[model samples]
Target: MKRHSIQTYRRIIQITVAITFIILPLLNQLGFTFIWGNFLNIHIGDLTLSDPLAVLQVTLKNQYFSPRLLMSAGIILIIAMCFGTIFCSWICPFGLLSELVHGLAKRVLPNTFKKLNFQISGFKIKIYILSLGLIFFFLFCTRPIINQLSMPLWYSQIFQYLFIQKHISFAVLFVAVILFAEFISRNRLWCRYICPQSFLLVIAKLLNPFHLKVGYRKEKCIGNKNNNPCQKACSLSLDPRTLNNLLETECNNCGDCIVACKKLGKALNFQFSRHFS
Candidate 1:
């Protein structure tokens, strides 16, 4: 196998492990719980890695906030900055669905794929404000109102409102819009714009070791700059050649760029740090 294909295999394993950690409990197969089999859990070898979903629940519950939770949140945020949306790319169920939508969109609308920027600046501006509110609500309110009330979290109403399919809240409605938008756009808009989790991850990932990078051979990358299909093919639609270009943290490193480079036969390919191996 080629060097890059080997790296891809490693990444797949990493993601599978992470997703399994989150998925097992929902099946009642993990065999432990926080309170009398109510809150399902497991111990990782000896030390519990903490149920990722439970950890998320604790983060959203004002009652569960602690120095430990804060510390964990910090750690998660740091990781996100480096890998950006590793959770979405690798683990999230909804994210997997979004990826399917993206594949279908690419097939159905090849020219429109990644051509339109669904990223609204006003929406970007609100993420900071929303993040601040979550922090404040976690610290001061009766519930971590903003966090629990997050649009993505609302989907759990699928189980939360299991028996009685009642009316949806504003947050749920917002989540529905995001889901609908996934069908309408190339990449899922919710993952790109509104997810506070990705926001935290972006922070963590930025300071960590490395990012999905192209071995940029400028001599080769320059071709049809005015109508660069490589940039147009990017879900984030970012120009890869500009001097200060790594600003787009929404990249899931799905290898679309790799395929684009190959499509145009551009002299570019992914490079990973030795640590990732």
Candidate 2:
């Protein structure tokens, strides 16, 4: 990942962003809207996206949630927990946007955002709210429905907004979800702090070897050499110089370390390895 070519991964992300957010909407503008998402009963990966528990917990109108859908959700969850969030960087729009935001935040915030603290209790607030809210609402409200003020479905329903055309209420969730995760948390407060979709990714990152890790050559990391590139490169405020715990789980595999190491001559490098290690 160091001293190589342009990251085709980011290119793939840019292309997907265009096709999904741009092309799909443009197609809908021409009255090209179809129930393509519904014409099928179920597909293999559809479950992962539909996320039965996700849809069930929310106010969204379900178009698909077959048994296969449930199975895919389960399997992907198992995989993500063991493999870190390949989905976060590769598949999730929020994740990709967050990565972009990480770069932008560094440039813009300079002092404020970089110095922010990611306290454990601060991180736990999302899940605490989600769990307690789900129980309280289910018990009181007659509809045993799911609450989704912050889910991926909320976002997809956003893109589907330009297409749905008629009842655009679902778009409200889209807007609110985006405004909170995108504008507010900076990057991945939902995924890192609130998302159940993140449940497995957190486990996976905790156990996966391929997670973004800091290779700190202990002696050199101390600043008599007067160098601190790894600390500077971290977008997550995770200083590679101080990182001994791989179980931080919040590590998104963006190569801030690789970027940081260019000045340090490979003192800090990130490579694929077992999180179980």
Candidate 3:
């Protein structure tokens, strides 16, 4: 029997997370208090998990430390340090939606619009946006303003508002609009450029030199240099062959490229090393 690809497993996990969140809110409404809260801060029995960026905003605004919140956020950051941004690839509901939308765009959109180039780096744009958001929050906001930018949080809260409060949130429209724009542009714009939530995860991943990343072996590669299947397989439009260079920071270790290369030359694989080489 043929083995399932990495993307198949990733899609399974992503769908499970998405469906689980939808169910969690319903369970909470029915007095199933074992797992509670949205993606910004969630509790599974005694264990807590939180978005690091949300925790940072709250910590900065309150000017006081909550050990529980700190530990919760630290756990996420530690995972990012060890495994890169797997949350983005494997668990985020928004990510799953974006990937599906992107895939549809690729299939239906014109070839001319498939590869649009941006003048500035997507990661740099994210950093700039993050800086401005923090500045704005520090200057005038009383609440954790950055938390509003989290798509995952909004995704979870959509179910929370529907099941618990019986309220229809406009956040569903907000997410739809973003997905529509991405489909039109044939780019995963929110994930690649606009997400402030991923900035902290990227930073955490950078801090750990030996974090999990796609390792490339040029010698093992037998495919056409001009037209590589690995590059075509990447949903983020990243080149797996050049992952050792500056482009490494943008990679979320989704392993789509590795799966694509498996039959061609088996040139790409996941590894934990100080450098991709």
Candidate 4:
């Protein structure tokens, strides 16, 4: 399928998941017992799908482990290994909002909203944040505290609360604050840097050298400085022209660059291969 079609599929998946979470809690409150719990700990029928980072934190510090949690996390990791952190693009509810916020900022205030390109990579900073979070969890027993930082989880929790308790949560404020910060930064600051939950999925994706990823054919590219649509289309500010191992780890394979290049040079397209091999 074309890159645009693939992106449309992703958006449909994202929106469906977001709406499902909102409805599940409401159904449960209305005497339906099929699904329960928020994004941190989801229970659908007899199966459970909990956040891996949250499970890891509790397991390490409290010495708690459940077969259901491991199974759920393992399933997610396996998917990530094959698809390269697609959860960030096609599943995570907050990603939709973040993308929208960034897109709006760029259109409304193009010059002022242009992000400050940092010399440092987001992966390095994300690793540091993950390490610090684990350390704090192990030392201070601050396990649930880290959950507050999860924007997607917060989105789910907000709906869960609104449905279960029939009230709004202050977590909506946290979502608002993060969206505002991302709007100002004009980048995916949280997903790229601060979101510890994504770190494990990224690591899982790195394990599979051959996976679905955006492939750049530099020779095919009709290099043009003024009409660099691929770069502009990239939400994470990654240069899709450089097809390498590093790009595999950083990119969520959203296919925006590929779509951007479609009418231009057709230089970028989705390919499954071991580029290093």
Whole-structure CA lDDT of model 2? 0.51
lDDT score, candidate 3: 0.88
Off by over 4 Å in 3: 112-114, 244-246
Per-residue error at 170 for model 1, in Å? 11
Off by over 4 Å in 4: 1-4, 63-65, 110-113, 142-144, 244-246
Q: If scored against the real structure, what TM-score would every candidate get?
A: 0.62, 0.65, 0.96, 0.91
- Tens digit of per-residue lDDT, candidate 3, span 19-75: 999999888878999999888889999999988998898887898899989999999
Q: Please list all clashing residue pairs in model 4, or write none if there are none.
A: none
The TM-score of predicted model 1 comes to 0.62
Candidates 1 and 4 compared by TM-score, better number: 4
Among all windows of 10 consecutive residues in model 3, the one with the lowest summed lDDT is: 242-251
lDDT against the true structure, per candidate, is: 0.51, 0.51, 0.88, 0.80
lDDT of 2 by residue, 1-277 (tens): 5554224665487457535643455555675554123201113232323443453443323434556556645565555645445555556665655556656655676465433356563235645765776686666654323435434445455555556554465656554555445444454455556655554456545665555554555554434335666655554556555554432555555555655665555555555464322
RMSD of each: 6.3, 5.9, 1.4, 2.4
lDDT of 4 by residue, 140-186 (tens): 77565667678778898898778777789999888899889888888
Candidate No. with top TM-score = 3
